[model samples]
Target: MVTKWVLLPVPAQDADSIELDIAERQRKRGEPTSPSAGELSDDELASEMLRRTTFGAFIPWPESALERLAAATTETTRRWSIVMTLCAESPGTLFSTTDISERTELTIGEWRTACRHITPHLRKHYKDAPLWGPGLYEGSTEWPLVTMSGRQLKLRHELHVGITEEQAKRWRAVLNRTTQNVA
Candidate 1:
């Protein structure tokens, strides 16, 4: 089974409150919130939800989503390490290959090669129904202007393309869970 660790920005102690706050805000705005505020706390809870509730199988790391992701694949190890480092430097914006290379000492060519190596795996595990067009990769734009949504969408399109219906459903569940956690 593929496993991935994601470094959720929400701290364990703050997760519950954040969820509540989001729910309250949604209610006030009359907008729907994906996974109600009472849904999760910490990476363990998120992983439990992903396993017991979604994929019906246990993933290896739950202490921190990033830890699980780190253990999932050697290729992902490099990609996520770079991603986390980029996130640390820039909180909400996307980072291009040049930005990552310049910031992390991975050359632009090296970054592209690493991304290409991991693209198939990311597509296989994380892609859901194409909400948008085909997903975007590092070399799509000028270099440093790709957004998170673009990368994720591209991965999802690659994964779901020609997949069995049942597999798609399961994949969608995983995607939804991820969306919830990120939100």
Candidate 2:
């Protein structure tokens, strides 16, 4: 039997709430599937609300890569949402040292050092590493997410990060949502 999974970045702090939401989706809100979202377990529903009355944690990276990025420093995990969001929106745009902090919401000088070593490695884990990792562009023509100069932010790659088929699907969903929202 094949199992399906969704790879959303439900932080440990938000997991319980998300589980509650999933249950809510399965039960109370699946009305299109039934009168009470009924008969079928709450999970048997066909319709669910896109905007649940709850908040979801913003997770920029998933487990495998997030750990490595976090380990790069105590900070990458914290700053990635803003950083990745900017890069996803404008790939290959050179943000100077000053620009990164102001535009990307990164604290001043935060990305100055650890970024070079950390950003490039994301390519090892993600083809489109920006969604789930640092959006780094070092202007190497031979590689993806590359630019004409090795400065600024960008993200592009194909998935090669030893993930389950289910995880890949989740990644696809993540990429799609990121693109859709940015567009």
Candidate 3:
């Protein structure tokens, strides 16, 4: 009979130090995260105004937005994720429900249902929401952002390079006024 074993080199750190390092890493992982903006409710908006106001513009929302979109569970938010995906491709660009459906692989009806759900949370510069009339395509979604004119779609805090500073300022004023009216 014979027995054999192989030995592998280990770091020289003491057991106590290794244990302390593991505990520190675990504790760091349990640290709390700030509340998500999605947690806010329309009713709680007034009470949470200060917190909400601090929520700055996320135009061209970071790549993390795609992660959020892919993880969306609800119908409305799922649609928002889709629309935002297209818009992100060309910030301040125009797109329709067809574009959205084609891009996201969702049915037109389903896309519309999702679009209706997000209409309220979006900006309404004209008489209606940024989207909802003579969209990029007929009978499709309209611009889903703060807009000053037909082709000037206002992203969170970004404007197309062609737009002048004066126009951007005016758009800001218009958006501010519209936002105030809603509040």
Candidate 4:
């Protein structure tokens, strides 16, 4: 007998809650709120929101490689849903080439090349902010772990809610399979 293993990356923290909040807001308000506000004009607000939401956490990657991999891999509906939810919730928290290589058991070089392939698409679609200059974010240059205000918190909450629902679905499926085997 052979055992097959499937490796799925765990959803980031608060993914479900954030998704729920976003969905609810869209339903009730009919307008998505900006992720953050920091005393700026309209243009500045747009730029800042784009920067904060789009690519704050994740490392940049190339486009072609990502496309090939996304095409080749057979992602389940659940996985795709999770990915979409993640992108909506926090587009900035992307995996770097190195991070992807390490997590997915791919070679660093391969991951880097793939990242290069996908990056252009990400840039074009996501419109991430420019890289932070030296001495930003409490003088450490790292992405801030905490959201800046209540609005950001609400968005994050919705993302987590969506993640939770997905997790519950997965867990229930596992339980059902186990029970069927036992019977």
lDDT of each: 0.42, 0.38, 0.41, 0.36
lDDT of 2 by residue, 110-131 (tens): 6544354445554554453334
Clashing pairs in 2: 26-42, 127-157, 127-158, 128-157, 138-150, 139-147
> Which has the higher TM-score value, candidate number 1 or candidate number 2?
1
How far out, in Å, is residue 102 in model 3?
2.0
lDDT (10s digit) by residue, model 1, range 1-183: 222333245678999998888778767766765444344446445433332322222121222333334344666555655554354343333445555666776676766676566545544543331222233433221111122322333322221111222333343444456568879
Per-candidate TM vs. native? 0.33, 0.29, 0.30, 0.22
Q: Which one is best on TM-score? A: 1
Q: Candidate 3 on 1-183: residue-level lDDT in tens?
A: 121111222377675676566557655767323224555444344423322221222122222332333445567666655555445445433445555566777777886676556544333212332223443533332333322321222222222121223323433444455458779
Query: What's the lDDT for residue 107 in model 3?
Result: 78
Worst 10-residue lDDT window, candidate 3? 53-62
Off by over 4 Å in 3: 1-71, 119-183
Ranking by TM-score: 1, 3, 2, 4
